[model samples]
Target: MIVRPRPNWFRMLLVVRGSVLPAILPQLLITLAFALLVTLLHGRVFVWKVSLTFVPFSLIGLTLAIFLGFRNNTSYARYWEARVLWGEVLNDTRSLARQALTLVDGPAPSRIFVHQLIAFVHALRHQLRGTDPAADLDTWLSDEARQRLQGARYKPSAILLMAGEWLRERRRQGELAAPLVQAMEVHMGHLSDALGGCERIAGTPIPFTYAVIIHRTVYLYCLLLPFGLVDSIGSMTPLIVTFIAYTFFALEALSSEIEEPFGTEPNDLPLDAMCEGIQATLLELLGERDLPAAPKPVNYVLS
Candidate 1:
């Protein structure tokens, strides 16, 4: 997220701030310490004597390493894909809002529909964050809309359906003709797909058992890596082990963090900011005052 690279190492280090060590830092510390101790005592004091021929442990560890690499790679792909899909959703939501305001015929319900569209954005942010929208939805929602959402199991979807029903009613009253109404339906469908896509990503996560397996394998690999290298590497085992552990651990940590890129985390997708952008665009069409302002991230971090 650090754009415009600073030449100074100190500045760059500060830029990377809390991206440093994770909760698994303790494991890294243990791995490095064990590696140094074994390497120092490798030939001088003892040998683990684990090998593919004499001991089967070495081959097992090697196989685990290959599995670790592949697991991390696949998880990273999922993480990246989730972000990309959300980005598309963000764009499409803006487009839907624009169409809803401009194309829909106006007055009471249509004007209310424009506001509800904005409320839906925040509702979606709440849905993604797994929180109630009661705190923030007041600005965009009317009393009737809020009352409808009171016990709704899925608030965002409910709000969306309201928009659809409103559209149908308008068409019924001859407020919108077939072509314009059909065009509005298409945009509404796009919003529906976007909502469904995000819901799918949230509802169906990577299998828990596979995650547990990958975590256990990474731990086992680090544990055995020291023993394998210590006999040959000597005192320098600490540095080598740390470097290797850092690379693997970093990848694992990154994949996990980004897998659900819709939170308060530094790299979380800019859903709130994106929603505000949609609000602004739609408000321009409604010519509404008290418009929502974009939430600019502090130090390039948007939550």
Candidate 2:
């Protein structure tokens, strides 16, 4: 994700790091070249003159823009929902950490609970991004705990189960009150809800056929635009078509990037930074001053 101050308008026009320009550059170039060719040939295919008026394009463009706007809104909703789920995870984990520290009796058990909570956060992040959790798990989990998670399909759930058992054991030992344990359990359930929400978003996506139709329509419209404009606009057809194509192409590219918000793309949620922030905040609650360094944006992009 982009994590920089907004640039001036002039600079914004040339900004590339977090924009969709790179993804749609090839399509834009193709549109530009095709428009130029059509203009030069006077919208002709050999001896056949391809005559088209701007009327159909005007109507189609209006409808196409509406569809694109709808799709973009749907994609942004997914992106925003994913971010909200992560925010819930952060808040719930912090609450759990506080409960373990203040309510639990022993330092040793509380430390174990806090470490497991940290592990759970990193595990969920890795799970969402489809990355290995071995390194992150090893950092906060015991050898026995790591072994238990070795072949576990869902590492975050495994860590949550471990945390639950930790709480149960503490309760059995008369270390934690029944009421406080129930309170912590509520936070744990919130964590589970967040995990499930993230999973649903990651597993289900906008229908491929829907995306395909919009993608095909955008490209076809851009390619056919020159034929419609060449007769009327004459020499300006290439510039006009290419400018219009850029908008459609860029929007499609951006929507595709954000639809899967858990990805490592520049526009995707900064899961790494988010997980680290959760770890830091929880560790700080445990009286640790020296924490892991926060992730910094590289070249104005965070991942």
Candidate 3:
């Protein structure tokens, strides 16, 4: 995700680091070339003159813009929901770590529980992004615990189960009160809810047919725009068509990138930084001052 301060308007116009321009550049060039050809040929293919009025283009453009706006809004809603779910995970994990340290009697069990929570955070991040959790798990888990996780299909859920067992053991040893156990369980349940929400968003996407229809319409409209404007706009058809195409193409590209908020794209959520932040903050709660440095955005983008 982009993390830099907003640039001035003049610089904003030329900024490319976080914009969709790079993604849609090829489409823009194709549209420009096609528009120039149409203008030169006077909207003709061989002997057949392709006559089209701006009226149909105008009506279609308005409707298309509305549909695009709706789709983009839907995509942004998904993006925002994913962010909220991650926020819940962060908050719940912090609460769980606090409970483990303050409510539990022994330092050994408390540290183990905190480490398990950190492992769960890292595992959840890897699960969402479809990356291997081995390195992250190794950092937080003992060799035996990591071996146990090797057979578990869902590493995050497995870590959560480990955490629950840890709490149960503490309770059995008379180290934690029944009420405190229940309180920590509530936070654990919230963590489970957050995990489930993230999975749901990652598994289900906007319907394929809806995306296909909008994608086809946007491209068709952009490609055929020159024919409608060439007769009236004369030599300015390419410039005008290119500008219009840029808007549609950029919006479509941006929506696609953010729709899957777990992705590593510049516009997607910064899951890497988020997971690290959760780890550092939790460790800080346990009196550890030698924490990992916070992630910095590379070229104005955090991932």
Candidate 4:
């Protein structure tokens, strides 16, 4: 995601990296051409005068803008929810690590649990984005655990299961007290909830019907706008139509980009930076000296 400070008004006008304008440029150009043609012909082609008045366009435009606003709101809600889930992941993982380090006596089991927690975070991130987690998992998990996760349908859940079993083993050996075990279990439950929330957001999307209806309405409205304006706006039809079309088309494209926030789009959540932050924090809790440097935004993008 783009994480720069807010730009001044003059700079904002020229900002382009994270905007949806690039994706909708072709549509803008086409709208301009169509509006120009309609203006030149006085909304007449061959023997037909397809000229229209502003009344219908005005009514349709108002309704279409409302629908677009609702759609954008729904998409933004999903984006914000996904971000909140990741934040929960970070908090729960840190809590788990702190509990294990303070309550558990055996350093080996505590270290193992922290490693598995890190693996869980990495696995969840890669799984949501549909990328292979083998490389990251191998760094922390054993050959047996790694091989086991390779065949599991959901690697994050599998890793969490390993963590649970590890805690159970320590409890059986009288290393972990019963009360601490229950406490750690609570944190583990939080981890499971975070995982489930992320899966829900990644798997289910805003309904396709809403997307289709908004898409067709925006295009139809933009295309017919020139016919309505050419008669009254005269030579300025292209300029006027193109400007309005940009607003509608850009909103449509922006909603589509952010609807699936797990993907690697510029507007998507910064999962890489987030995962790195989690890793650094957990390793620091373990008193590791070779901690990784913090992640920084590149060209205003934090991916």
Candidate 5:
């Protein structure tokens, strides 16, 4: 989700202040210390000459790089696809709100029902993040509806089903004609599809064995890199290998962090904030005096 160009080295040092650093720092120091030890122990015996690569190191490094790249790329694609699907949800929610304002008669319970629909959006958002849904619902929902969702699992889907039932009932009564009810139900169906799409992404993940293999290979590369370079590169082996190792491991960690953007990480996708957009879009149609502000972005990132 980070849209900025890859930072230069100076900025990168600052930007890596998150999870990647902790994983990299230890490997770097270990490489450095061992590099120094080799220089002290073999400084006199080996010439100043240095050889950069052993055939196997190059092969192994390339293999790891290609495989890791493939994994990360696939993961990012899945993450971005999820984002696009959620964007559709936002657009469809707006469409639903527009349809509600135009089709439903403006009267007694109309304002209340429409506002409750907005509450359902917020409720769905909080539910997805495993956050408490009880408080966000009260302002938009009837006491009974709020109670139904408060302790329940699948909060968003529950509210959605309620909305569907409301439409069905209106159709049964003389209030809303069958055609209008069907049109509204179509939007409701989109809501259901969005929920299903999100659930699929959340449930499915890259195989654990694949992730484990990638991790183990990265560590092994870092560990064995010194042996390949120490004899020829001498004192420089540690620093050089560590630098190279840092690049490999850092990319690996970053990709894994963003692999499931819905996850609760500083770098994860901003579902809560997207849900806020839904609220603003719906509430504005109701022409309420006061509307809640949209969810604010963090330092630079949204959600």
Candidate 6:
């Protein structure tokens, strides 16, 4: 995601990062050109009085705006829910690390738990983004663990299962006491819930019917607008149509970008940086040196 300070008004007008202007530029230009042609035709083409009034357009515009607002809100809710789920990931991982460090009797076993926790973060990030996690997981997991994860359908859940099994093994070996094992199990459940939540969001999306209806409505409104404005706005029809088209089209584009919330879009969540942060925190808890550096934003964008 773009991670810069807010720009001043003048600079903000020209800012492109995290903005949908680029994606909608073609649509805006086309609408402007159409409006220009309509204006030159003087609301008539080839002896045809092709004209429309502003009244119906105005009423439709109001309802269209409301629908756009609703769609945007729905998209933002998905985005925010994704953020919240990742927040839970960070919290639960930290909590698990703390429990393992304090309750587990041996540093060797505790370090294994920490490595698994860190690997789980990377695994979840890779799973959500649909990227290969072999490189990320190889360093933290043993050859056997890594091989077992290879070709696994749900790698993050597979990693979490390993972690839980490790905890159960330790408990059986009398390394972790019953009460503290129970505590760790609770945190493990939180991790499981977070994984399930992210998967649910990634799999499910805003209804297709709503998306189709809103998409057609926005395009129809933008295309029909020039007909309504050319006779009334006269020479200024192009500018007005382009501005309105930009507003409507940009919103639609942004909603589509954020609705998924896991892709590598400029506005999508920074899963890489988040996973790195989790790794750093968990490794520090395990007193490991030579920790990987936290991810830094490039060109004011983090991912």
Candidate 6 per-residue lDDT, tens place, 1-303, comes to: 988999999999999876888898888888888888888987777898866899998899899899989999999999999999999999999999998888888888888878988899998988898888889888999999988987799988998999999989998999898888888889899889989999999999999999899899888888777888887778998899889888889888988999999999889999989988988988888887888777888988899
Model 2 lDDT, full chain set: 0.93
Q: After aligning candidate 6 to the native by TM-score, how far in Å is the CA of 216 from where it should be?
A: 1.6
Which 10-residue window of candidate 6 scores lowest in summed lDDT? 42-51
How far out, in Å, is residue 270 in model 5?
Answer: 1.5
Estimate the TM-score for candidate 5: 0.85
Cα miss at 72, model 1 (Å)?
A: 4.0
Candidate 6: the clashing residue pairs are none
Q: Per-residue lDDT for 1-303 in model 3, tens only?
A: 999999899999999888999899999999999999999999999999999989999999999999989999999999999999999998999998888888888777799889999999999999999999999899999888998998788999999998999989999999999999999999999999999999999999999899999899999999999999999989999999999999999888888888999999999999999999999999999899998799999999899
Residue 130 CA displacement from its true place in model 5, Å: 2.0
The positional error of residue 277 in candidate 2, measured at the CA in angstroms, is 0.7
Off by over 4 Å in 3: none
Stretches of candidate 4 off by over 4 Å are none
Q: Per-residue lDDT of 151-225 in model 2, one digit per residue for the tens? A: 899989989999999999999999999999999999999999999999999999999999999999998999999
Score residue 86 of candidate 2 by CA lDDT.
93
Quantify how close model 2 is to the true structure by its C-alpha RMSD in Å: 0.9
TM-score of each: 0.83, 0.98, 0.98, 0.97, 0.85, 0.97
The lDDT of model 4 is 0.91
lDDT of 1 by residue, 1-303 (tens): 212335597666554444736555777898888777666666233533543121444566466668666766776676566666656655665666566656666656667787777788788888988988887678878788788888898888898888888878878988777788787777677777777877877777667897788778777666666666665555776887787777667767766766676666765577767777777777776667776566765775665
* Candidate 5 lDDT, 178-290, residue by residue in tens: 88878877878887887888777777888889999999999878766776777767678778877888888878887888777787676788777777777776777777648
Worst 10 residues of 4 by lDDT: 144-153
